[model samples]
Target: MPILWLTVIVLALAALGYVIGRRRALASGDGRIRNLHSLPSYYGSYVAMMTGVPAISLMLLWLLAQPFWVNSAVLADLPVSAVADGSSSSLVMSDVRRLADGLDRAVAQGVMTEADIDAMGSDLSGIRTRLGNVGVALGSDVSTDILTSAQDYRTKAATGRLVMSILVLAVAIVGFGWAYQRTHKDFRARNVVERGIRYVLIAAACIAILTTIGIVLSLVFNAIAFFRVYPASDFFFSLTWSPSFGGGSELGILPLLWGTFYISIIALLVAVPIGLFSAIYLAEYAGPKVRGVAKPLLEVLAGIPTIVYGLFALLTVGPFLLGIFGPDGVGWMQAGTAVITAGLVMGIMLIPFVSSLSDDIINAVPQALRDGSYGLGATKSETIRQVILPAALPGIVGAILLAASRAIGETMIVVLGAGAAARLDLNPFEAMTTVTAKIVSQLTGDADFSSPEALVAFALGMTLFIVTLGLNVFALYIVRKYREQYE
Candidate 1:
């Protein structure tokens, strides 16, 4: 049976259990609703939980474990010499899986029978033609060893799935019967169901934490592997950025880091003041009608995809800047693709991020503070500058930091606007690339994963992670210090 059908069967059984459990609880109470300790609905929910949760959990575990068990079983039957020249055991296993699937499809199409496939043995051309007629392509001729392994792989996988379906259904049935038997007027169904829900919530939180840990660990391990081959000192301190697959590549991060921050600083300079001023005007100065109409228009920038921003940078912003500063005019900008273009476009992308958050934070400032400042004979501007801004400073700082992070991590705008030239130059008009752009370049297109060139992507990622983490920590420290002072 397919897993989908099995799921349906378990759900049906659980539904049946719910009905029975609800009726049994009411019957035990002599059909008097007040006689039950908990509600009849609670009893039904408890039975459903008991029937579905355990079976689903078991099925999930079996699904995760089945591949590993079957892969090992199939690998054991594979001959040592089955791995042909310039190929690996993994590659051969891939072929085996493909052939197994093709054979199954051929049988389903009535082009081949089970007995015929079993006896086909070393009939490479014949099998290929039959499989091809069904639209399954094979790269190489089928060998006796591979053919045998495919059959065994198919058999083992089918058997495992069958056993899994049976066990899951059995567990569901057992849970249903057990919970039904326990259904009574005195049974604490509500408590059991509530406890189960709490556990599920706890598990969800733990999964999130574990996922973060796993991502960090993966970065650390790959970075370690990279640094072992490439010098950590050079990788961290060198002012160059070049990667050659063969050897002797100057993989320096400083130039990339400089570009990344240069663009981000420009972005912050553009985004912070405008976003903050707009937020203040909307929050403190604008009339209700204007604010209502204006706030949504400002926030629409946030809803726009980063790719659209990239296209705007490429077609509109980049060309416009170049027209003003390029060789045809000021002779400062050489082409449309330059750091200034990326920075300006990225800043536009971050405006809504800064404005929306700052607006909320500024609005959260106490009305009492504003009134007190007014009572002190301060004008509206003075009150805003001294009272509202200071009160909302911590949250404003947080919003700025969040925008900075987005600016730093932006890839599309940089790729489209800033030309991919890793150089330690000072001119914003000059083209430069960022760490994110370099990471994409290093990993793209026919790159060998084992080489330092490819592995450097991980090291770059880890460096970016550290930089962002430090920024977050610094932001938290600032927020806390100021928050404490105000409190």
Candidate 2:
């Protein structure tokens, strides 16, 4: 049976259990209004939980475990000849699985009968042609050993599926009967259902936390693996950025870090003043009609994807900058793609991040501060500059840090606008690149993953994670320090 059909059957059983349990509880109340300890809905929910949760949990466990069992069985059954021409057992097993699936497809399409498949000799004659007729292509002719393994694989899989279907239905039915018998007027069905929900919520929270820890651990392990093979000193201190998959590559991060910081600095220089001023205007000076029209327009920039901004940098902004500073003009910039172009476009992309967040933060300032400044005969500008801004400083700083984090992590804009030239040049108009761009370049194509060239991507990722974590921590510290003053 298909997993989807099995899910439907389990849900149907749960629904039947719910109706029966609710009716049983109400009938036990003898039609009296206040005879039950908990509501009828609680009894229904308890039955549903009991009927669905165990069966679904069992199915999930079966699905997770079956693949390992099946793969182990097939691997053990295969002889030494199955792994031909330096191929690993894992790769050979993949071929076996594909061939098994193709045979099943052939059977489903009526191109072959089960009896015919069973009675076939070990020569495995015409198997490829028959499977091909059913739209399952093979890279080579079937080996006799592989054909035997695939047939065994299919048989074991069929038996497992049959067993799973029977077991899942049995558990669902048993859970239904158990919960139905326990449902009575005096049972604490509400408390039982509430406890189950609490455990579910706790599990969800733990899953999220565990996922973060898992990611951090994976990065740390891979980075350790990379450092074991490649010198950490060279990776951290060298100024060059070159990687050769063949061996002996100089995997320096200084050039990439330089480019990343230079572009992000340019982005911040463009975004901060403009975004802060816009926030000030929108929050303190704009009328209601103007605020309504302008706020959404400002936020629309955020919704426009970074990819679109990258394109704009590539096609529009890069060319425009080239016309101003390229060799054909003032001879300062060599091409359309340069650090300035990417930075300018990235700054534009981050403007909404700064402006939208700062606007809300400025608005969150207490009205009493503004009133006190006004009472002291201060002008509106003076009041805003002295009182309102001071109160919202922490939040504004937090917003700027967030925007900086966004700028540091941007890949597409840097790739498209900033030319892929990793250097520590002083000129903003010159082409440059970032760690993210280098990480992508190293891992892409037919690069060997075990090489330092590809593994360096993980180290770079860990660096990014650390940098952003520091920024967030600093932002939190600033917010916490001044939050009491504002409150």
Candidate 3:
């Protein structure tokens, strides 16, 4: 069955279970609500939870596990000769999956039948043509071994899905029957349902924690692999940034780091003052009507996609800056793409992150602080400078750090505005590239995954991750110190 249909059927069963359980609870109490241990609604919710949760959970687990199971089975049965020279098993498995999907599509499109597929043993003559008709283009002709494996994969996958559907429906039906039988007037349905909800919440929290752990581990492992092939000392300390895939490459991270920090510093210089002042105006001085109109207009910059910002930097800002700083003017800039271009655009992109967050933080300062300052004969400006700003300092620092992180991670603006020249030049008008832009460059096209060039992307990502993590830790320390002082 289609997953959508299965979900609908399961939901229908749960809804029916809810009505039946409620009625049964009322019947057990002789239709008197006061005689029941819990409310009639609690009994119905308990039944609905029992009917839906276990079955839905099983269905999700089955879906996640099915692909792995199918891939393993197909790979184990696949012949060694199927994988071409210089190619990995993963690539072969990818082709097998695509071919299997194509066969399924071919059947669905009425171009082929199950008997045709069964009879088509290792023949690549017409199979590719038929598959192409259904819009399934393969990189190369299908081999006999690949064809057989795909067939086996399709068969096992179909069988597994069938078994999963049967098992899910069975569990749902059993849960409904059991819950219906247990829905008595004295049953503690509320307690049971609440306990189940607590577990679900705990599971969600664990998933989030586990996901973070998984990301860190992946970066660590890939970076370790990269270090094994390339020298850690060169990667960390060398000032150049030249990556040649055909060996003898210089993989220095310093230039990239320099560019990243240089651009981010410029961005912070532009963003912090403007964003903070705007926040002050919005939160402290603006009238209600003005605040309502101006705040959203300022925040709308945040909603504009990074790509749009990148285009603005590339086409408009870069050219505008170049005209002033190029040969016709100061002659400091050689081209349109430069650090200043990306930094200014990125600063614009980060305005909302700082302004909106800082506005909220400034507003969160206690009104009593302002009144106390006023009572001390302080003017509004003096009171704001001393009391409101101080009270809101911790949150504002956090907001700035958050914006700094966003600046550090920005890629599109850097790619389009900052030319892909990794250098240690201090001039903001000169072209430069960041770690994120280089990460994208390193991983683009048909690069070999096991090669140092490709693996360096992970190393760059790990370095970026560490830098952002340190920023977060510093932000936390500052927040804690100020929070303790203020509270």
lDDT of 3: 0.92
Best model per TM-score:
3
Task: TM-score each candidate.
Answer: 0.89, 0.87, 0.95
- In model 3, where do residues sit more than 4 Å from their true spots? 480-487
Which of candidates 2 and 3 reaches a greater lDDT? Answer: 3
Clashing pairs in 1: none
RMSD after Cα superposition, model 3: 1.8
Clashing residue pair totals per candidate (backbone < 3 A): 0, 0, 0
Indicate the TM-score of model 1: 0.89
Candidate 3 vs. true structure, TM-score? 0.95
- Per-candidate Cα RMSD to the true structure, in Å, reads 3.1, 3.3, 1.8
Best-first order by TM-score? 3, 1, 2
Per-residue accuracy of model 2 over 1-487 as CA lDDT, tens digit each = 9899999999999998889889999999996648999999899989999999889989988998998999899899898887766676866788899999998988988998788788774546578777878898877745788889999999999899999999999999999999999999999999999999998799789889998999999999999999999999999999888787788799899999999999999999999998999999999999999999998998898898888999999999999988889878898988889999999999998889899989988988888888889999999999988889888988999999989988999999999999899898999998999989988898898665667988999999999889988998888787667667667
What digit string (tens of lDDT, one per residue) describes model 1 on residues 169-209? 99999999899999999999989989999998998898899
**Distance from true position, residue 332, model 1, in Å?**
2.2
Task: Please give the ranking of all candidate structures by lDDT, highest first, separated by commas.
Answer: 3, 1, 2
Better of 1 and 3 by lDDT: 3
In the predicted model 3, the residue pairs found to clash are: none
**By TM-score, is 2 or 3 better?**
3
